[model samples]
Target: MMLDRKGNNPLLAIKFFGEGIRWLGNSKLRKFVVIPVLVNLVLYAVAFALGYLYLGDMIDRLIPDWLQWLRWILWPLFFIGFFIGGFFTFTVLANLIASPFYGMLSAATLGIAAGESATVMEVPWLRVVKAELRRAAYLGVRAILLVIISIIPGINVIAPLLWALFGAWGMALEYLAYPLENAGILFSEQRKLIGSVRWGALSFGGLAAAGLAVPIVNIVVAPAAVIGATLYLREIEKK
Candidate 1:
């Protein structure tokens, strides 16, 4: 059941979306959806509040004397803090919303590794939180390293692109890790599973990530993408 490692399977992208739609039917979408939206609202509020508290004074002091006249130029940088804060907050929240479904998806994805039919079942919140925290800690460290790289003058120009890449990979890993664990695979085994089909996972994940970047649209898209990622794992196993 180990997937073919040599090529990308484009059809999986379509299947991913279709499966996502199907998975959404399992829920009272209104009930599941409301929590994520509220989580998002809380995230935004926290982001804004932190920005005003921390950045407001920092920007005032940090704005150079000569650049004081160009306060507008420094304005956007102040908001970067908000985005950074929101990024981690959203990841935690998205995983929380999708947690109930993750075990079912994981069962399918990991069943391939186990050479068996995986039962679809509900995942407990504690399990989801534990799994996500493990993966998130790894990605958070990598993101910090990427931030350091961006501080370098010559490299800073490509920082945006690098961060985007990291974000995409992080999302894919986060999504995949849940299912892999449910199937009783450890982190190392899950890494191997994904490593074999990295391109397909990354490309499909990047597409799903488009939803994460949007505002209101992201609320629906986030859980959908997790489902998509789950389906993506199932399809990849067939290859």
Candidate 2:
């Protein structure tokens, strides 16, 4: 499990993510991935179902009759937005609900990555919940700000790019939290650690976000992300 830490290669994150998928096949790590995958499957299925049912109505409401011609252009953008938004939103909720399991998964992955036995660590449910709440609040406030910017006059033009970056950064923070917390790193410090390797972290998160946008692929991406984040942190610590 020795990771390649040669240079500050942004694509290294992607390799770690792939390593995560490969690690899922490891018998020792297989058990740790199950619950998170199931949680993702259920949450995403429901979210996609609801989105499918209401997406048409939402699009109609957003575009007036005079702008009917714009539907052809805006429809795709709206669909992409809905997909990314729904994925990130449900991802946060899923991670919150499954935080305890994720904690154990991260610990076990760390153990395996270190060439040790896969030991399930005890999860402090209360603390994990509180941490998740803090992260949610942090993300929520920023998300609201982004939404406001999205609706502003000229400044709104770059909103989509902003959201894309935010989503990538958010995904990095979301997955990286488990291992960082297990290592006794606080939320504030975790941000700094991620910031230190911003591009690599974002690459990992961006690819993860992209993978989760797919249908069946999204189901396993959560657990894979957990493993990937663990690997990413391990490499960061080595540096």
Candidate 3:
């Protein structure tokens, strides 16, 4: 996976996802995808339902009867609030619950990339689960800290952009950690390798962030992202 750590192909991140989807026809990889997809779908459904319901209630309460004329403003605000809230909440919760399985999927995909039989690769479920939780907790803490920063007065204006940057970087770190770990690389080394191709990782992660923001399409984003990150790692190794 670190064979070409310096290769900076910015499009590779997104290409991994596209190719991963295409690679699913291979059946073996598709098997790894099923559980994560199901998990995402269920989590996303519940998240969206609850988020919008809460958003609707909040809007109704906030808008005054005289402000009914501001329906246009309130409607868009409702949608924006729901999407933002649901995006982070749904993604965080889904990933947290499915962390171990995602590691398994990533390891299997790494096997496929190495031309090794997926069955031959022994996925340590316990280790993977613990690692995933740690990664998720790390991300969650950073996000919380950023949200806190956004609450500050002078810097509040750029908080959203800052959060987007964090989101993009988090996507890269989160997804890539799977294959890197499978290859026995340390998280510190993974960060350095990724930093060498920082822009490419950003492109990859930014695209992922965008995908996760979409409604129904986001259901497939998790597995697809893992596939893409795996493919991207393999691609770099060949360089």
Better structure of 1 and 2 per TM-score: 2
lDDT of 1 by residue, 92-199 (tens): 665765565555544543443346654455666677677767777788799889989999999899999988788777776766676566656666677677767777
Residue pairs of candidate 3 with colliding backbone atoms: 16-228, 17-228
Best-fitting candidate, measured by lDDT? 2
- Per residue, candidate 3 scores C-alpha lDDT tens digits across 1-239 of 44464446676566676876676566887767788788888876776677678867876898888877787876788778767776777787787677667777777777777788884345576776677667677788988889898899998989989888888888888787777777777677888878877888887888888888887888887788887887787778754
TM-score of 2: 0.83
Q: What does each candidate score in C-alpha RMSD?
A: 5.3, 4.4, 3.1
lDDT of model 1 at position 19: 69
Superposed Cα deviation of residue 161, candidate 1 (Å): 3.1
lDDT of 2 at 211: 82
lDDT of 3: 0.76
lDDT, candidate 1, equals 0.64
Which 10 consecutive residues of model 1 have the lowest summed lDDT?
Answer: 25-34
